[model samples]
Target chain A: MTLYFMTFILFCIGMYALVVKKNLVKKIIGLVIIENAVNLFLILVGFRFDAEAPILEEGMGKMVAFVDPLPQAMILTSIVIGLGVVALLVAIAIRIYEKYGTFDISQIRELRG
Target chain B: MIELHIILFFMILAALIAVEMRGLLNSVIALGAVGMGLVLQFLLLRAPDLAIVQLVVEILILILLIRATVKLDRPSESTLKENWAYVLCLLLFAGVFLWFGYRALEGLPLFGAPEMNVSDYYISNAMEQTGAANIVTSILLDFRAYDTLGEVTVLFTSIVGAIAVLRKIGRKQ
Candidate 1:
């Protein structure tokens, strides 16, 4: 409920910045927001109230009171992927600044083709 | 019933506000919030895959922004008649989108809910084909390997692009 709306709002906001903003940084921010909103949405979708972490105890035959473990694993993978993207993006940004002499995306108007 | 929608309304308002704000960094931060929110939604819907992708993309994007902004300065809040006019046009655009949204939800998502219950289908027979406890992986990589291949290609393209971009810089330096 509250979570769903928040996620959507985040997505729309990111889209807006990506579309409307001329600053490269702002647009990047917009991209980040979009990514976060989607991640949050995914997490929220799988949540179950009062469910414990999916941990199996010794001599416990698949205890029934456990939250799904898949999401947690997915989150870990997502975090790793995010790190990779961030590193690549940062490298790109550094190069763009050196070449363009500015971070204002509107001014990086060399690409007309 | 109405609680979720009401919250969504507020969130939309916030998103619009962030977009309208002139501060580039602030807008980007707002965008991060949006990404986090998406992950939450993915979790709620039991879709961890989507959430993970979102998180990874967000991190990369944020780094790109910060790096890109190292030499850039924020634009001044200069008022212009055309800008306001454009803003008005955007408002109109939002109105159109709202109408479309309403229309979309009218019969959406579950055009034929009973017949297309993917969860049920996966649960009942996924083990037979892939023998993995995680049905999603089997569906994504085995039952639907094409989609997975597409995803891998997209990532591959990005990695290659990044490498090319970096190599050009090395040559210039």
Candidate 2:
């Protein structure tokens, strides 16, 4: 579907930012974008037209059409992982700024071989 | 469907602006807008649980980024040739991945027709097995509880790592 292709395009945009940006914070932002794009893609894969949320009601007999919930659960874990990774990245960025006194990757070349 | 497409378009635009913007703070804000667009898309796609999680996580990330970058000066720009190299590398990477991804997509079951026997079993028996009305919750807490446990461990480890890293910086100052 067009929608799924569009999500891939978004993923590519994130990849572009990640590779092309020089600022450390911008790189982290790009990483976050890539994480979100994957989550969106997974959720989109699980969606069904006209299907309700996968919540069963009391005495609602024979639920016919509920969207898949497995991908939703997996994505929940992924979103949480993204949060942790971002937090760690920001902390590291702060430390890198403290040591190097700059946020530009080009200028912080101590680690370059 | 058209509405969903419109939102996806806006999301892509926001992503572009976020990537291309000059100011770091403005780019972060744009990224937040992209997150909001994703939240809306999740809601529209019948994933309320993901929508809620995304909303809270996005706000928290925005706060963290703002706090980290608040006192820093403007980032210096890289050289033009380096930028071109970066762009070319990404284009090549994207082209390869896109081709593989499209091929993979064709092999996948069509949209709205999930063919997983595991999911079917969960859908049919989750209520009786877990007594949870929400299938997502049941799957998360009851069926695949070990995965949740592992996820919690990962979160705990990251928190510890962050605190340790930040604490070192404080002591050095």
Q: How close is every model to the real structure, measured as TM-score? A: 0.64, 0.94
lDDT of 1 by residue, A1-113 (tens): 44454565566666666666665555555665565556555445545555533333346444333333444445544455555565567567767767776655655775422
Candidate 2 chain B weakest lDDT stretch, 10 residues: B73-82
**Could you tell me which 10 consecutive residues in candidate 1 chain B have the lowest summed lDDT?**
B108-117
The best candidate in terms of DockQ = 2
Alpha carbon lDDT of residue B160, candidate 2? 91
RMSD of 2: 2.1
lDDT of 2 at B26: 87
Number of the predicted model whose lDDT against the real structure is largest: 2
Q: What is the lDDT of residue B149 in candidate 1?
A: 65
Please give the TM-score that candidate 1 achieves against the real structure.
0.64
DockQ of each: 0.24, 0.76
lDDT per model vs. reference: 0.54, 0.87
